[model samples]
Target: MLLFRLMSALLGYVVILVTGKATERFVNMAASRGIYLWDITRVREGAVLLKVRLGAVKALRHIARRTKCRFHFERRVGFPFLYKRLLRRKALALGVLFFLGALYFLSSFVWFIEVKGTERLTVPEVLGAAAEAGLNRGMPKWRVEPGRVEAALEEKLPLVAWTGVYIKGAKVTIEVAERVVPDAEDNRPSHIIATKAGLVKDVLVLNGHPAVKEGDTVSPGQVLISGEIPPLEEPPKPGEEQKQGEEANKPKKPSRFVHARGIVRARVWYDGYGEAKIAETGRRLTGRSETRVSIKFKGKEIILSGDQNIPYELYETETFVKTIPQWRNLEVPVELVTIKYFEMAEYREELGIEGARSLAGERALAEAAGLVPEEAGIVNRSLEEVQTGHPENIVRVKVTVETIEEIGAESLFKP
Candidate 1:
């Protein structure tokens, strides 16, 4: 039984591999011969299962003669009677059953959409978006294109700034980011204000009068622009037809509110601290990389790297697959794939202070350089301090940059 099982598995793989390879070679040969085979398939033990558009008979004869194999002609049909009969007889039957079972498992519609790490969004809203993206009830496994599906969902759901989708068997997984609505201004009329102290480098005014101009020095809460202005006309006196009299004739007060739109790049005095430490300290780092390929009926996850020779480490792997619907097309898999990684590696006191500090400084400097604005100037640098224990012992470096840029910004509008 075991031998038969082994043979069955081997035969299954052999058929798939041979069919794939033969189809590829046939394509290449046909292309070279100034012929085009639009469609092709391979059936090893039977008559020509595939009908090639380009040199059909000739290619068959060529292959048969080259491999010392017999060739026969047979009609292709919707129901592969001979193939089915052959497959049902032995271990091939088990493979056939397995393939059919996998197909069956993939047919059910995705019932639940479990979103992880969503704060402002509700579950129903996310699911509704998924439905809009065609990932809802009755969506075939093959038809659920995760990338396309996620994109579509994001378009309709404004709250989700970003999303990732995955499918495991019948369950569809969604990870969502909620739209962060900035705090609104008090209900009363207000003016746009500078959030920090800066010399006005530039100013744009929309919908409100400009209070500060280019080259103006301003403090926090000082209005950069004003929206609300005094009324142009006085109120009606003593209820003399207040609704329809002078009150109506009086031009409405110019609308008062914060200037709705603008970007101000200002040279602001700011302090930034970046620190690096020197020590031979080990730290745990997490790296995420995933690889995927179709295996058997379902897709399997494969890791290409990150396995290290250390004991104080942790590793985790996650896999997901969505199957396609049709089986006749051998080249296209019914299976879709995704892989996730969570790995942790730690280093101990394998080295002393100076070395660790140096490495930390290098890393921190790299980070600082990456973060620095192109036109910004470094105003100061603090000495690297070597301290025991985390972040400090790991490495510490502080850098300060002076730049003309606006950082603290808030919009008074609801959107």
Candidate 2:
């Protein structure tokens, strides 16, 4: 019986504390709007007390000019010990929650590391590289210098040719590239060969015998300079020993050096295809004003901005579907803001044979224009034919154009 009475007293104290806090907050909020709380206390039945406030009533009366009772009246008394205990409990709960939240934010980077493009590199090697790059546990991600880290990683592992490091929230993503190995096996004896089937395009014989002269038309794989040597050197016969000795005394012919340059044109076949749909597209505005809030604890930021907004249209032939759930850094939903623009409708049309042919011709011409240099005049354009197919509504057209210009063919050998 005594325990139950004690529990009831504690419960009453908590209620009084919460009600006092709520009333205080409400009065403060109202005071900002020029309203005040007029509190009054009066003695009631012996130990009981009656408290009344007319501040809200007066404010309401001013607004309406005729109010009877806009304010609430309550009577209470004799629970000082219970009120103090409840207030303490509420404060303790609030303090504990605040502390826990702070601790969670401070130590939230205990997750796993994700290494992308690690085919050539082992996971441990990539992790080690990241550590060397200053990306480690408990370290604020933004502090990991991307430029310095990439340079350090490349210096440490020569195999990682190219690298990109991004700290997405807590995940540290590392994209890597392996070093390229050149082919060593020579089908023919290693020689200085013409790179292209051009008129010996400026041959520079570094360490070989010259075979072709300038302006000579050489085929593909043709040796511009030879590394081979004659089996034996011509020597004077038994009677010409003195003559051979005199020749040796003379300076040996300067190493057979040659520099050949020529111009040659070949029928370089090239095919280009480009596809452009009549569908709608939108470009984001750059000068538009945007407000973003970033919550950071220790260099790690929580972005409160959403991705770009694309418009959608109903009652129109074209429709753009866009959906955004939310962006979260650590299970906490970030802010989201979206703006959409509805576009006008577009009518579909069926193309006849001539229309299809004309469209195909236009596409082919556009492709050809891209292939030939802008300065190079497109003299000839021969359209083969326009072939149409069913089910897969497509028009195929082949266009051949002729232009006189220098074109490169070295990228085909690059790895």
Candidate 3:
């Protein structure tokens, strides 16, 4: 049905009203003469309404005269009539053509340039390389060559390992991947010092003299490895008695300094305290909430939805307000306000003395565990309960954690 209507519209069609005693004879004559007519309906005693193709309307006049029937057009439709209307309004047609031409012309130039996947390289640096290759913003898309941009980036920036240039509509995207380079080694004279007070478990000197050994106790800021090496002194021969005067006249050699590097493992201890009450009381959410939205203008509010009053006896309220944006001192006084009410219930828990003690100990241990470094190896843990003179309804626990970890840190000083 849709296809038939589309064909009728494209070829143009007309609705006509036929009247006379021979209206039926006119329809039969038109159909027999290959002039198609459809939707034939009897309107009155001698009048009939129907539709015919635009090309067949001229032939219908001769058929109506031969059958002694007269007819007039009720409505004219389809593209042929629309084309005639356009011919009468030249300015509107010209405006449409100008809009399409402007759109086509503006889309050919790049408007936006975006750089992606650049961490070590700054955006300006990447854009500078691309600009040198004729891929800058506002350049025509046809003139931009992706191969040349990629090659230029790799050549100009030695840190960039890979690059990709793509043009999508009016936006050009340049993706860059930077190479990973190791930092240069420091050769300045330094010492490895203790960052915390602990007992040294092991010490291995890589480029300096050892200051602290195994089973040695060291305090914060104490040197674990010394960067200075003293010159060795040789004893005189057994029978050389006169060499004492020559030795007294000779000058002593100076000590050599170097950059100290080493690992110092030590045993560290951490303590945490926790307390819990036998009876606990708090408020918790019931997961039931109600929301109300309204508009506020000059301190007056108009409710948009939800109830006027809060329904829950005990609840918490959260409010959010949004107002129209202001432009250079022009501001709207109206604001959209949304309020949410969350239902809350009171809760109380009762734990016996033993249960409270266990909970307090667990809390203390968890607190102590958090203080331990990730690289530390746990060696031992212990918990102790504290008691006062009077027996109370609370339990207090203290936890101690021992860990073995590296404690060496570099400390530079003037020689």
TM-score of each: 0.32, 0.33, 0.54
Ranking by lDDT: 3, 1, 2
Superposed on all Cα atoms, model 2 deviates from the true structure by an RMSD in Å of: 23.1
Of the candidates numbered 1 and 2, which has the greater lDDT value?
1
Query: Which regions in candidate 3 have their CA more than 4 angstroms from the true location?
Result: 1-185, 236-250
Error of 3 at 17 (Å): 55
Say which prediction, candidate 1 or candidate 3, comes out ahead on TM-score: 3
What candidate 2 gets wrong by more than 4 Å, as runs, is 1-61, 65-96, 103-112, 116-119, 129-156, 161-169, 173-177, 185-214, 218-415
Model 2 accuracy (lDDT, Cα)? 0.51
Give a tens-digit lDDT track for model 1, residues 1-415. 5774454334331111123334455445546766443334554533223433222445645654444445344443223444667666867777778999977875566656677867877788877777777777657667888998789867888777888998887778888877777655434344577877778877876555667778888888776766554445655578565555765596665555543445666776543334433334444556644444433343543433333332233756577766666667665644555545556666655445666556666565666567656755555444444344643444555443355765234445431
Weakest ten-residue segment in model 1 by summed lDDT:
12-21
Question: Which one is best on lDDT?
Answer: 3
Candidate 1 local Cα displacement, residue 75, angstroms = 41
lDDT of 3 by residue, 274-386 (tens): 88988878888999999999999999999999899998999999999999999898998999999999999999889888889999999999899999999999999999999
Off by over 4 Å in 1: 1-119, 125-188, 194-198, 217-221, 227-255, 259-261, 268-403, 407-415
